[model samples]
Target: MVPEERDGRDHGEERERPRRARRPAPESKRPAPANRRAPAETRRPATTARSAARSAARQLRDLTGHDPESVTSVERQRDGGWLIGVEVLETHRIPDSTDILAEYRVEVDDDGELVSYRRARRYYRGRSEERT
Candidate 1:
């Protein structure tokens, strides 16, 4: 075959040169260095004392009637459980005020189960009891 020329250039010379291979598209849009860590790797799971305290508070509220006046204090025990002190703020038809103004000692396990419960002390509604 005869070589053809256009504008004083040889078409055969252009065809003889090798064309560049096309590159593959990048696997991800984000740059490699910035996207290296997965979402789970970047963030740590959270645990806190406040979360435990709040959980204990919710448990106490559920066990006792949702009476704001009933619960006096809540404390976390050394064994990772809860110690809740509840006051008998009001009672219906009980003759002795001591029976009405009792203090309930509630023990809750780490999983918020009622481990044990009892009336620790009784006092008159209008008077304090002397400890012996």
Candidate 2:
């Protein structure tokens, strides 16, 4: 009588088939996460005209190192941006009327970045322009 096989495989096949060895994937040099920019760089979209005006005023103060008094006007541009008018306090005086104030036209992009700014007019706090 033939002897019973100890392994599960048939008598014709090898007892144990060897497994193919796998090579590890090589590591590639990638930029570190610290080099990546913050989400703030993506920027927040400008929502309302009032909010844009406020943002312009705050940005102007930071750029010019002056105190912003009030927002004079806010106009929407064709590019979905905003042309904001900001009134900044240039100098203070005992008589409030004599205080120096300036009007600046600030262009803010849709991404809330200050594209450009220029001083449109300057006058005393009490002075009012004659509308034509």
RMSD of each: 16.2, 15.4
lDDT of 1: 0.58
- Deviation from truth (RMSD, Å), model 1: 16.2
- For model 1, how does the per-residue alpha-carbon lDDT over 19-108 read when each residue is reduced to its tens digit? 999887678654457656557545322323344445544564566653324666677776667777766543544555443456767676
Q: Stretches of candidate 1 above 4 Å error?
A: 1-68, 93-99, 130-132
Residue 112, model 1, lDDT: 62
Per-model TM values vs. the true structure: 0.41, 0.61
What tens digits encode model 2's per-residue C-alpha lDDT throughout 17-96? 78989775545434336866536535345567777887899899999998998898998887779999999888889799
Judged by lDDT, which candidate is best?
Answer: 2
- The superposed Cα distance between candidate 2 and the true structure at residue 95, in angstroms, equals 1.2
Assess candidate 1 and give its TM-score to the true structure: 0.41
